[model samples]
Target: MASIVDEDNKKLYIFDEFFRKGMLNNELAQMIKDKGYSKEVIIADSAERKSIDEIKKLGVPRIKPAKKGHGSIMTGIQKVNQYEIIVHPNCTNIQDELDNYSYKKDKVTGEYLNSPIDSYNHGLDALRMSIQSVKRKARILTVKL
Candidate 1:
């Protein structure tokens, strides 16, 4: 997800995306360069440190590891949820993820858990990583009827 942030208004305008599976580091580097993001500071998943290093070496500048740890996912979810996210019409995958991402459900009583389901979150994870330093007080999500 490529975005422009409106910090004062707490808005995240996601304007572009490249969502493809099994892409190699070189391909990713080329994408960043082709998309004109060579100079931008990109926050990538820390889990892919080796890949990030390879991309950096491949000539895309300022690739930083995402800040992550225990409860980080939920924290990021809350942080992003506070903002009004505006997605580009062309970014269908992002729109789909935002619309479908949800909390997990309990089996026995069918209660919705606070934890978020892992599915449909790749783009969202990138978005969350992008704004790791930006903070917002978390609000508990209540399901709507």
Candidate 2:
């Protein structure tokens, strides 16, 4: 789980759980709603096209696709730093991902590469998507007015 404070400093917490055994869209949507995040936005992986469609069928609101690429991930990380981030203690996967996440290194020059290591990144990816989704929404709102 992750929490973010908006421009008004209002805090909102969003949760996502991945079941290795796989969960039905209805089941997952109910679980999320039970957690009191039914009104909050959900950022899902675009790779899960079928799952996204199924979740939509379940009537869950504000489901958005996460922007892919290192730049989007980096932007999310920056946004996290900009806001106060509160992680639930039970969110060990997120903590472990943040702890072990690193940038690739050049073999000959020993310089850090732009790409990030793919391992231990599931939680990180979810968090990144959430942040990016908020940022995108904010941008759209700004453009509208």
TM-scores for the candidates? 0.89, 0.69
Q: Which ranges in model 1 have alpha carbons more than 4 Å from their true place? A: 134-145
* Lowest-sum lDDT 10-residue window in model 1: 136-145
Which residue pairs show collisions in model 1?
A: none
In TM-score terms, which candidate is top?
1
lDDT tens per residue, model 1, 31-117:
888888877767788888888788889997687788889998888888888789888899999899989989889999899999889
**TM-score of model 1 relative to the true fold?**
0.89
* Candidate 2, number of clashes: 0
Best candidate, lDDT: 1
True-structure lDDT of candidate 1? 0.75
